[model samples]
Target: MAIYELRTYNVIVGKMSEVVSHYKNEGWPALAKHPQKLVGYFTGDVGAINELIHVWKFDDDADRRAFWAGVYGDAEFMAFAAKIRPLIAQQQNKLMLSAPWGPQP
Candidate 1:
């Protein structure tokens, strides 16, 4: 089964656009190049108050780990993360797999 990672960041009001753009240009491309990650998307909602949601699809847990290990250790990724740290209040994430269907080929 394919897995998806969902992360929510509580971004400071004025920084949402900036943070989103940064992710669009840097993080998104970096993740897409990973061997396991298939795609990623971001969403913003007023209901959550300056919230940013990101969804990432991966082949499996091992693949997810490998991709993250590389991204986390890279100097450029580290710098980008640092740049957004102050603009965020807190973040939470969950890893989920697509639900299987009852009758389908």
Candidate 2:
């Protein structure tokens, strides 16, 4: 089964653009290099003040675990995260296994 790593970040009003831009400009490059990351980005939406959602696909649970362990321990990633910390209000995560009932192929 294909697993999806979902992160939803709530950012301060009027700062979502900044949050988005920061991820694109600085964060994405480093994340793109990660072997387990299939896709990552932020998208605007309702029900939240502002949203930064990232979806990462992995081959298996071990792959995902290794990737996150390294990501959380990386100095550069930590720095990048710090840069955006003050701009965000909260963050949530969901780890899901894809289902056939989801959107059509």
Best by TM-score: 2
Cα lDDT tens digits for candidate 2, 19-80: 77888787776666667475756577556547778788877799899998888887777878
Candidate 2 — number of clashing residue pairs?
Answer: 0
TM-score of 1: 0.78
The candidate scoring highest on lDDT is 2
Error of 1 at 51 (Å): 1.5
Which stretch of 10 consecutive residues in model 2 shows the poorest summed lDDT?
A: 40-49
TM value for model 2: 0.80
Where model 2 places Cα greater than 4 Å from the true spot, the runs are 46-49, 100-105
Task: Spell out the clash pairs found in candidate 1.
Answer: none
Query: Per-residue error at 14 for model 2, in Å?
Result: 1.6
Each prediction's TM-score versus the true structure: 0.78, 0.80
lDDT comparing candidate 2 with the true structure: 0.78
